[model samples]
Target: MTTHHRTRWLALPAALLLALLPASASAYPNPGRVTGDITVHDPTMLRAADGTYLLYSTHGGLEARTSTDRIAFSRSGNAFNSPPSWWKTYSSGNDPWAPDISYRGGKYLMYYAVSSFGSSTSAIGFATSSSGKAGTWTDYGIVHSTTGSSNYNAIDPNLFVDDDGKWWLSFGSWWSGLKMIRLDPATGKSYAGDKTVYGIASRPTGTKAVEGPSVVKRNGYYYLFASYDTCCAGTSSTYKIKVGRATSPTGPYYDKNGVAMMNNGGSPVLESHGRYIGPGGQSIMSDTDGDLLVYHYYDGQAGGTAKLGVNLLSWSGGWPTAY
Candidate 1:
């Protein structure tokens, strides 16, 4: 969430054929099942009301695309608001990144981040669409803000409705790491102070930089997936997908080796496959088939850049393994 999370060396993504590998092949699914190339990054996808997987990925600013097959895609449109007045528009500034699109109360709710690097002054704003398409989206200014001096650099945001139907928002930076708070479902505001941090992905104890927290559940296990080290620095980022699992939503998550996730004990679910660098900043979706972990990887298929990758996810032995 914070702008302080810098980039590391790029990792070439693994081979695309790993998608066809049998699910029982390995414990960790690094190269996902869904395959293709388009340079998708910080991806957020949903099975929309119209039966389309509407993928809103971070394209400098937020852009909309849709795919029914999950492999083929078509661009839909750009950010709903055309850049709000409060957010600086200098040099195509204050991009809308890492979006969370959901349908509640028969209306679509979109939570998007507006910020630029080297500045802690960031904000997570809200938008809405009646049809979840190109037209009719209204922006609500600044759901949360970072003064460019805050320790917890607010950026990547995730919205979830728990088992009890309680809504909450999880966000923060790699500097101070990831955090969560109860949300006012009616207002989309934090019910408690953002200070009450729940999950913190601090920089490997001695080192720094850890952000992009995504939380989901599978087969009664709550899996906390996050990208640590660096992302988007081309070949300099040391991006990897690490996860901690728990029995409950608010963890106390443990790795496959029985180590605690809160204690920085996450087994690797996604790491670089040579040139597939920074394969993190992930999201998940479910359909008639199953759950899918959607994220980005530095793809060399198009001369090397951070492109989006989707892999089918399966839970085995209480751990999340990609296909």
Candidate 2:
């Protein structure tokens, strides 16, 4: 959906709001308080076994930050002390974006993207580390890629492993919407046999504005969350988080009203309200308290600078509602 479309949705009556969101979006809560080195874009947060929060965001070689109590974060170092030499083959700047980190097989795996702005000549790369801290990444090279000839742009990667031990990587942007491919667990790359790129979600008619997919399984359902509309416009950005659910990981996912995600179907998880504008690029982390919605939003009070916003999710009604 476009910013104009979202603006109209915001103007709808309360009853109409129910058609687009799980609840009346006018009452969406402000983000939980955070301080110190909060500025970020496309933030992906992971808490290590030692109780430290390692947060990564876009650009500057995937800038890294850390926090102990989750309230006060401090700037750390970039994941790469030097950009991988192979990066220049795909990205002109050699700067990476949207790094997704996960722990599996007693190792830390990070999947990131190398691309320039508004371009489809992009590549998705992978790295592994014994520890997920800064300067420890060992580049495994490109996992998937796309050229200007391709319909999809390969970026914003999210890895979802199912209960049956299947690995899937979902990544895409503007041109043809979200795409997923089965991954080999051992190599952390695309599976050779089933190389089909699954089309998960898109806006066919209006703005093709969905990206940043994060999938998590809860109570027998696999939820696919994505950012909608414009990002990086600071306070003017219309970015918000939307979600759909399916029984399988590579899904014909559906929203609350049974609309298919592939047909532009999504129920609002978070959106612009008050000082919090354009809350998106979200990742779900199951914390000690509950499922934390970790994302970045343009802070209206801070000259529209991007900042981290964390909110606990309530899944009481079988759909995620942020409190």
Candidate 3:
């Protein structure tokens, strides 16, 4: 494994070492150290075949950043030189948010959402790039969307390709929480035969703030990691990363304590600690050493600036614990 991909526990202080003990509501660890051009929101990162880390996030035409060591990042420009014309329909400012990037079938596919704040008339857009870098993306148009009449808002999309060769896209925000749909891998769009909109997780009783679903399979279990509560309010943001697990990707997921995720059940993976406030908008990335819990947090020390946060995850006791 590369030096950047190794477990970094040895460098952490005693207080931060408490993160490895168990999942606790109030004992979350501070974000691991990162520097240079780290200001981001709803960030997603993937290491390219050439071992360069490409990080993408909300706004600025889905802003791009690059890192060779995964510790020091440099601004690399936007994924698109010009926003797609269709973006204006959902977001008047043509702002795209929460980009999910993955490498599949010899190409890089990006799934992103375009919508104004708190609007249900949202659309999830698709694009492809051979290089997974700025200026190479070709917008493929909408894969899924919603209107004010719909019960769920379509945004914060994540594409998960199951081990059995099934492609699934999980997305949604506010309105009615997270939803999933089957995708056609051939065209990178919704699958025609399966018109099912799977309900994965939600808060039925209070605060329907769950969004940003990142699904990955480990040890024969499908784990769903999502952001819970409010996001984007700077220091006052209540966002925190939570998780659940199920036997299937389209799941009736349960938290660590056997609470159903569809009814607001989620085990806390990371939350506010010290200078890190509202740590959420997360994506899980697999590295050589282990799975990484990659997300953005409002930096209280920096006057509530959104900054990139990265931490290694340990799946001990069948639940993810971030340190």
TM-score of each: 0.83, 0.91, 0.93
Model 3 residue pairs with clashes? none
What local lDDT score does residue 250 receive in model 1, on the 0 to 100 scale? 62
lDDT string for model 1 (82-147, tens) is 667866732246567788878888888888777777556777878787878764578877777777
For TM-score, the strongest prediction is 3
Q: Local error of candidate 1 at 177, Å?
A: 0.8
Clashing pairs in 2: none
lDDT score, candidate 3, position 230 = 84
lDDT of 3 by residue, 1-323 (tens): 23443446567787877766566545776677788999999999999999999999999999999999888999999999999999999999999999999999999999999999988999999999999999799999999999989999899999999998999999989777899999999999999999999999988997888999999998899999999988999999999999999999999899988999999899999988878999999999998777889999998989999999998888898889987
Against the true structure, whose lDDT is highest? 3
Misplaced by over 4 Å in model 3 are 1-26
Q: Write the per-residue lDDT of candidate 2 for residues 70-174, one digit (tens) a residue.
A: 889898889898999889977888989999988899988899999988989999999988888988889989999999899989999999999989999998888
Candidate 2 displacement at residue 166 in angstroms: 0.7
